[model samples]
Target: MLDALAARAAGPGRITVFEPSPHLWRGRPYGPDLESVLVNAPPAIMSIRHGDLGHYAAWLGGRAAEHLDPLLGEPLVPRALYGEYLEHTAETALAALREAGWEVRVVRSRVTGATGAGTRMVLGTEDGQRHEADHVVLCVGGGTPPDLYGLDGAPGFAGDPYPLRRTLDRIPSGSDVGVIGSGLTAVDVVVSLAARGHTGRISLLSRSGMLPHVWQRPVERQPRFVTTDRVAALHRERGTVALDDLVGLLRDEIDSAGEDFAAFTAELLAAETDDPVRRLRAQLDAVDDHRIGRRFLQLTAHTVGPYAWRLLPAADRARLRRRLRTATGVASPMVPVNASILMRLFDSGQLDAVAGVRAIEAVNGRFHISGDQGRRTTAVLVNAVNPAPQSIPRGAAQLVDALAADGTAALHPDGGLASTDPRLHVIGDLAAGGSFITSSIPAVAFQSARAAAAVTAASDSGRALSG
Candidate 1:
């Protein structure tokens, strides 16, 4: 959506998209059962366009008594309200596009397969139909789900959590339910179930029993930061920077406006991939913090700046990769889950958080979670674990096989699930770009923008480009 929007806004090629869950635009990872899932990221930071940061707030202002909206005091508003806010912003964007001469095509079909030959790409839809795109962008950023295999009576185990929102609609008023994760989704399930007045005993199961950390609102400033200096010192001294110290220093830098907090953070993230020594230190530290290790996985993303995650020197990257062995690591980017939701579940006593299910054998009527916490069962078992190429419909696997067979693309290992052709970009839970974190708007926005650019650049037949 961001790609098509940017393309149209840039007066580039006609923008067309194939979104599987077409109506899912209102807010994703959405549910008919969820009534209390609030946007954890403050609405202020959640806008698609940086220029429209407080646009939703202004609308709420108009609706406020004396226009003093309570939401202002607390930026995290209910998902439903945010849904409306998203609709309004999207409508405004769509209207603007229509007013322009660009023809935007949005097809509501799952892209089961895609391949490129020369300048044209062939894409297969869920309905067995194929379409052509000058360039194709796979919005596959939303990570796939788990495959429930060796667990007891597991073949009968149903592996759907997100789509099962409707299953929850008819759930008993107060039933005991077992959640399989302590991450954000688990949290979301608890909160949503709570909103429905279902006071059930919910247990969250995970291997490490780690819950996500909460996102505290921005606090008043403290001191200055030195990025290159810190990076230089870390490289020179080969040591760790305390989290608090780093945060304080970075905050000071952002306050000085010598750098964009966003850009600086982006750089730090980029550096994690570029500077080998730094990336190794990060991975080593992260391995030790298994409780909330994923947070560290992200803090060191591939950086465009000197501070982010990037490839270490061959030696250091190799060392880092070795240290990362025990960690539940990703070769490519994966969706970041919600942590606040998990904490909410724990608070409600709805989550019985446990880890490791040896097998999922069945009992008299339902399934048993036979493993770490002994045998207990639930009426249903939904696989909420993050999906990889191994999990989803064979469509992706088959598509990837075809890509390799045709010699049109090469897999980038850490799942580069389907990025064989730059002209054919992939996003959402599928890209496997070493950074799959969430199916959130922010994640998608970043992915879509990149996809749009690649597609646009690939489609350039006679256009002058501007940077």
Candidate 2:
């Protein structure tokens, strides 16, 4: 939001930011963590500056090569290092806003409640202070990872395994570890453990045991058929976008690239039910695949995803929801570097992934897990389950509840704040009426731009009315 305002020179007003974390720009995911915890996406997609794809890469300059992950063929830098880029971008935006006659104040406090105050909105903070604003943009990050196993106070169990720096050390290097969930977060725990020279067996337990596909070396080809403009044109003509219509566009894109769409999608679906080790090995080998299917899906999943999602009929939306796990795995793939790490661990007989996790009990000083593969006990357990997209965080629950109770704001049936109220804006994962998938950085950047424009335009209109 600050970046958009600064870019537009929309100032001459005061802007107050409420942030309780010590790390200003880096939220929970990017805060100080082990170097092994990398930014999941490449620089091409991680930019916060909307429309400027190279913004992050430009900031990296010569430092890019130093943090390159060779297997991914892109600079998959550490999350902490990426946090530095966020901090730099934020400071630059603040400076520009100040120079443009904007008074920016940073309050190191968490907002607890929000209510309507005439034309303005009142925000109550945890510090027992209230402030009024013409518009409020809720940027409270994503929801907390749920304790699926009810292991909050259990010994040797990490309910939330973020900033692995704190959680990893407490785990004894020699203790056998069991990680819940086979997604990116679980991969982070495994890789960070290896980096810390931990010499214990590690097992990933999940319902599907499906791991994220490895990202292929990016190509220069742009989508010819699945572009947002094409989607908009379709919606104008048909009034709704069906699942078959989307598949048709994808088919055209793949065929135009001279690849067999049927074969590509077949392999993709098969990977979901394929053996873990074999699938990971195949993905590692296909890092340089020339096929355009995955790349096309990746590009459009964010850009055309939300827009198409809104226009999709209820039946089509339900169809997509049925395969949510597959969609998530394909859309958010792991870096080749981590895929290789998992393979090595598998080869060395130190790592394994099991599906059908039915029960997890904290036994006497150990974790006993029962799943499709029967039972296994580990000395330590880590919950790496990805949080549901746009679910409200525990800390901000009070504020959101207050708004919903007062009819000041409401949540979408799909999760996230509804767009019914103009006085209250939302960005990041909390924003409603977006793709069911969690908001990516690029998606968040787009939301921020829209929110900034709305706020500034309203301010301009108010001033004009007074004149």
Candidate 3:
């Protein structure tokens, strides 16, 4: 967002950012962490600058080789390394803004309340300071992972597994560790533990023991049938795009590339019921898949996903929600390096994942887990289940509530905040009425561009009226 504003704003204006964290540009996910924790997406899709496919890669010029993952055929850098990119990008943006006659200030405080003050908005911070702004954009990021088992203060329980450097050392090297989700965060915990030379047995407990699919070597193919323009055209013609309409577009995309749609859909469905080890093995073997279905879906997810989501009828949305687990697994695959680590652990009988987790209890200084696979105990338990999309962070909850209570903003029926005032905007994952998978960097960049344009246009309008 700062990048967008720097490039487009016709400003000799002031911009103040209230950030309480010492790691300014590097949020929780990209903060200092074990080298094993990697940026999940490819460089092409991870750019902070909107519409610039090679932005991140251009910055990684000479050091790309050091972070390259051979299996995925991409430089999956450490989270800390990526944080450096963010910091550099932010500094560059700030420099550009200063050159453009804009004064930018960063405040080390958290916002606690927001209320409308005549034509402006007044923001109150935790440190008992209030600042007024003509426009406000909430970039609070996502919420912390919830503790599902009521083990917040348990001796051996880790409520959040982030910055694993802080949590991993406390656990005995040979003690059993249990992770509570089968998503990317869980993958991080497992891979980081192995990287630290921890020989403990590890188990991933979930309602559906479905791990993310393995990412294939990316191909240089753009979608012809599944583009955003085509989706908009469909909505114009039919008023709404149904689930079957999307499937038809996908089929056309795959068939045009000379792949069998039936075979592809069947394989995707089979993955949900297939054994986790065998499924992962199959995915690993097929990393060089010649089929275009997966690639098409990956490209369409962020590019066309938001538009299609808005046009989808309630029934179609509900149907997609029913299969969200499978859809998310396919859309957000893990990089091959982590998949290989998991494979090695599975081969050594030191790691396993089980579904239908019924209950978890803290007992006798250990964690006991009961599920479909029956009872098991572990020396340490880590919560890896991410919060739902657009969940308000605990720190920002009071501010969001205040805005809603006073009608400055309204809570979306779906998640996130909806602005009632033109001066206020929402971006990133907190923007309401976005796709379920709207938290990606590409999506955030898209939203940032829109918000920046809106803010600048409004500023220009105000100036012209005064003149």
Best by lDDT: 3
Which pairs in model 2 have colliding backbones? none
Candidate 3 wrongly placed segments (more than 4 Å): 461-467
Off by over 4 Å in 2: 461-467
The clash count of every prediction, one per candidate, is 64, 0, 0
Q: Write out the backbone clash pairs for model 3.
A: none
Question: Relative to the true structure, how large is the alpha-carbon lDDT of every model?
Answer: 0.49, 0.86, 0.86
Error of 3 at 162 (Å): 1.2
**CA lDDT, candidate 2, residue 440:** 87
Q: What TM-score would every model get versus the actual structure?
A: 0.67, 0.97, 0.97
Model 3 root-mean-square deviation: 2.3
Worst 10 residues of 3 by lDDT: 458-467
**Alpha-carbon error at 341 in model 3, in Å?**
0.7
Of 1 and 2, the candidate ahead on lDDT is: 2
